[model samples]
Target: MIGRFKAELFLILATVVWGGTFPVISELLSFVDAAYIVGFRFLISAVILFPFLFKGGLFLRIRQGLVDGFILGSLTFSGFYLQTVGLNYTTPARSAFITQLLLIYVLIFQVFAKRKRPTIWNVISTVILFIGAVILVDPFALEGKLNKGDIITGLSAAAFAAYIIRIDHVKSEGRMVSILFSQFVLCSVLGFTLSFVQDAPVPIFNFTSVGFILYLAIPATLFATYTMLKYQPKTTPMRASILYSLEPIFATLITILFLGIWPLKHEVIGGSIVFFAVILSEVSPLLRHTTKPEPKN
Candidate 1:
């Protein structure tokens, strides 16, 4: 019981870090191109993780390195690419709601890949969550015609879902360290390469952009990735999936408190629906554990 709580705590912290990305990236928009922002993020993250890569002769575990590398890397990088670029066109609420479709995608992928059906509670919760998301996004409030950014952000959610699914495919007691390193390497190489290909402008050396990049590189990339890789397998994917919903909530709060940004009434109502849905889904499992019969002495 204590262990589970600790794990949840770590997951929450990871979610908070992820949530922080919204504002940090929003700030960086003034001085850095999205692609270059991603590129530098991975570049610095890879450098920070360099010591760990060689600590255990990481390359020696190379049976599926390349395959896992590209698959996870592309999924992770493409998601960021889509979300960051998409933000340029869409409101933050819309982008966050759309990106969060990955939660549903994760559940669906788990069902097919693992041959496991969702419990009744899972289905109910998912529906509730969707309602909340609709409220939060306020689809009617969209700025422009459904454009390339919206499509790309939606596609990015799917890609990120694929990445999470692949994490399940690579079976090991916990090869998380190696797997993460491979992912970082691939992301760094791909992002940097694409930066050049896209003719992304060079990032200026402003204190704000540099600080934002560092925050993203260290806490968001290194810490959150490490936590997810370490603790995700301990809990059901459903639980992990639901916990991630907290990201948008935290982001919303941060935006409100610091930036004085507030959601519309409908958006708030919708978000509550999504929040209730996730809680509804988890209540059954939580109750079952609490109410189960005691073991015989």
Candidate 2:
């Protein structure tokens, strides 16, 4: 029980770190191109984790990690690149809501891959979560027209969903550290290459932006990736998706704190609904079993 709780806590912390990145990255985009930001941030993360790639007697594991990590890293890169580019064409709120369609993609993929349909509770929770997301983002204001950026962000969500499923599939492979290190390195290389190809202007170094970049690289990229790779397999992919849906909520709070943006009434209501839906999903199974009558011996 304690172990599961700890694992869930770690997942939550990872999501929180991810959520915190929104404001920082949004700010950084003003001074740096999206590709360069991705490049330097991931390069820093690779540097932080580089030493672990050389641990003794892990050559076989490293080989496997290289292949698996490259596959995973490619998917990750696609998601981030599309989403960041999409951000240029859409509002952050719209981008966030669309990006989170990852949950729906994961659920659909799980149904097909596992050859099992979701439980009633799972389906209900998903619906409720979707409703909350709609409320949070208020897409109705968009008048049913999705721009190019919205479509790209939606595709990014699909890539992210595939990435999540891939992580779950590869959990049996050991050497998580090596795998994640490889992923960071690959993403860094891709980011830098794309930045150069696009001729994105180089980011001018300043204290504030540099600090934000380091924060993103260390806590958001390095620590968050480590915890996610280490602990996410402990939970069902659906549950993990639900947990991650909390990112928007966290992002809202962080935005309020850093930018003095107040949460609107709908955001508060939507965030609460999503939060409780997640809690119910986590606890319902336990409650069901506990309430069952004992069988006569």
Candidate 3:
């Protein structure tokens, strides 16, 4: 139990680091092209992780390590690229609501992939979690046709969901380290190659852009990726996704810190609901364990 919760804690921290990206990237896009930003961030991450390629030679042991990493990497890059571009087309609330759909996707996959129905509480928690995300983002307040950004962000959610499931399916335990390294390598290639192909403007070197990229490369990219590879499998993919659903709440808090924007009433209420949903999920498992009959002497 202790070990599981520790893994959960690490993932929570990873989510927090990920949450910081919204504000950081929003600021970065103004000064640097999004493609350039992606290119540089993942390039640095891949270089740092290059040493791991030789560690234990796990890549060789896990025959599919590079393949799995490529799949995960494509999903990762797609999620990021779509979300970044989607925001330009959609409101933040819409993007939040859509991205949080990733949890549902995982649940859906569990049903089909495992052929196992969710427990009652799992369903309950999922419902509550979804409601909380909806309330927090409050897409209903926006008056317009469903735009490209909303659709694009929803696609990003699917990509992210696929990424999470792939992590669970990785063949070798801790072999995901190799897979993650490969993912970074692929994203780095895609980032730079795409930037050039798309004719993105050459990014101006500045303290702001450099600082943001460095922050992203290490803590957000490397640490966060490592945590996901190492810790996410400790819990069910759905539970991990539930915890990840907190991304918006963390993003809201980040806005308060960096943009000085206090959350509106709806955001406060929604954040509370989402938090309660997470608590319910954590407690449900414990309650089940405690309720089991005692073993015979």
Candidate 4:
């Protein structure tokens, strides 16, 4: 029980670290292109985690790690690629919300895996939260304007949602460091490869950009990936996901405090709705399973 709680706490801390990264990366974009950001972030992360990769025997689980790494890294790298490109068109806050649509995706995957339909409340919660996101994003504003950034961010959201599902498969097969280190290395290579198509600029070794890369690679990629790979498997996907959904709440606060970006009232309202809905889904299951009636006379 204590172990489970510790795992959950680790997951929560990971989410907090990730949520806090938005403003930093958003600021770094002034000095760095998105592809360069992705590549360099993973490069730093790979550097940090590479030494730990061999703590367990290199080939003791080489075949499994490689297989898992390729598949997970491919999906993860694709999500980052789309997201970085998408950010070229969107607001950081909107991008954060969109990426978190993975919560819904995770729940849906669990439903199918269980071979049972989600409860009516579950469906209702999903719809309510999704609708809340629409309001939060507020697409109809701008006085006869459709934002390309928002659309691109939306697409990235879907891509990331799918990637979260793919990650679950890889989490089960190998050591976390080995798998995550391989993932960072592969993703760095993959991002570099894709950057060519975009005519990515040569990296400039600026202090601010380098610092951002280090933060992203270490806390966001390395630590967060390790926690997700290690902990998500120990809990139900829905539970893991709901805890993860806390990212948006944290992001909003960080953005407001550190980035000087104030959320619209509607965004706060919508995010609250989503937060409550997630609580309902995750807590209800645990309550039902754990609560017992008093003994009959």
- For each candidate, what TM-score against the reference? 0.82, 0.80, 0.78, 0.82
Q: lDDT tens string, model 4, 1-297?
A: 777888899999998988887777778777777777888888888787666656566666445477677777777777777777766666566667766555577667677764557766667677876887777667678664646765666566666766666765555544666666667778888777767778977776678778778888888887887788778877777768788878877877888888788877877776677677667766666665666576799
The local distance difference test score of each candidate is: 0.75, 0.76, 0.76, 0.73
- Which regions of candidate 1 fall more than 4 Å away from where they truly are? 1-7, 61-64, 110-119, 142-151, 172-174, 229-243, 282-297
- Name the runs in model 2 displaced over 4 angstroms: 1-14, 57-61, 89-99, 147-152, 171-173, 227-246, 280-284, 287-297
Estimate, for each residue in 74-108, the C-alpha lDDT of model 2 and write its tens digit.
Answer: 99888888887887775454566557667667778
How far off is residue 36 in model 1, in Å? 1.2
Residue ranges of candidate 3 with Cα displaced over 4 Å: 1-15, 55-64, 87-98, 144-151, 227-247, 287-297
Sequence-dependent TM-score of model 3: 0.78
lDDT of 1 by residue, 1-297 (tens): 677777878898999888888767766877888888888898888788767656546566443355676688888898888788886765555566567667677779889888878876667677777777666655566573445555667778888888878876776444555566677777878777887999988878777788889999999998997898778777777678678878778877877776677877876787677666666655668766776889999
Quote the lDDT for 139 in model 4. 67
Which should have the higher TM-score, number 2 or number 3?
Answer: 2
